[model samples]
Target: MKKSILLMTITTITLTGFISGCSRDYTPTAEATGEDIFKGACMECHDAIEGKENIFYELTADNKNIEFFSKKISGGSLLMPKFPNITADKLKAVSQYALDHSADK
Candidate 1:
């Protein structure tokens, strides 16, 4: 009787662990931030030190919209590479950050 009870307890504990692990939704370790995304990706090719003028100015001057910017980021521009892997939310955040900085001037 004690052996059966021990076996059942072990089975229950194993099942509980397995079920809990499977049910957990994985949370990404680092949430993407606009500034971090821009610095990591956009700055690679677009920094002023590289002799490329800041894109924010042109974006504002042309009255470009966030939707347009997000699409271009995901789809790539004539001079830019496609970033379709970037999440839509991250793109919007980055676009807004750029626009906000553009207006600072």
Candidate 2:
């Protein structure tokens, strides 16, 4: 009886956690700001300004600009995943914002 009760408790807790995780609102709104887009699209793989992997990429004026950022965000690289659904306006906003906050900027 105790074993059955324990199993039931574990199952309930696991299902609850899974359901809660799937209910998150990950999609950004139409009026979302640059910061919002960055958080939704980039934050999963990168920390605020740095990559989460072995190679740390600190943004700078030379390497991080509107064009570079926009291309990287839309098309992605070997390690990055492309964000095809992101609108042009959203991409521009995030790219400009990233350039403005680069280390040398």
Candidate 3:
């Protein structure tokens, strides 16, 4: 009886650990591509003059550049409307794309 109880306790602990490890608190964002998000949200005002060049011309990855642009989009700027409904991950992707394509290299 003791051996059975010990085995059951060990099994319960192992199963609990496995179950907890498998659970994730964050929901995975849909795989929205950079170009897709940019075209959908940003292209209305800023023209995609040369593929990703337009976004690159105005933004960068350094100096909190991505955060700056994300805030602008979320809060609304002089000429740009507030994209309040946009998800954080999508904004991040767009900012990353601009930074990656920027000519500041």
lDDT of 1 by residue, 2-104 (tens): 9999999999887666444321222212587877777666654554523335544454455566776677667765456567556657778877766655542
Q: Per-model C-alpha lDDT, please?
A: 0.60, 0.66, 0.59
Weakest 10 consecutive residues of candidate 2 by summed lDDT? 48-57
Give the distance in Å from residue 5's predicted Cα in candidate 1 to where it truly belongs: 84
Of candidates 3 and 2, the better by TM-score: 2
TM-score of every model versus the real structure = 0.55, 0.59, 0.53
Candidate 3 lands at a TM-score of 0.53
What CA RMSD would you report for each candidate?
A: 17.4, 9.4, 17.8
Candidate 2 local accuracy as lDDT?
0.66
Cα deviation in Å at residue 85, candidate 1? 1.5
Which residues of candidate 2, in runs, are more than 4 Å off?
1-27, 49-57
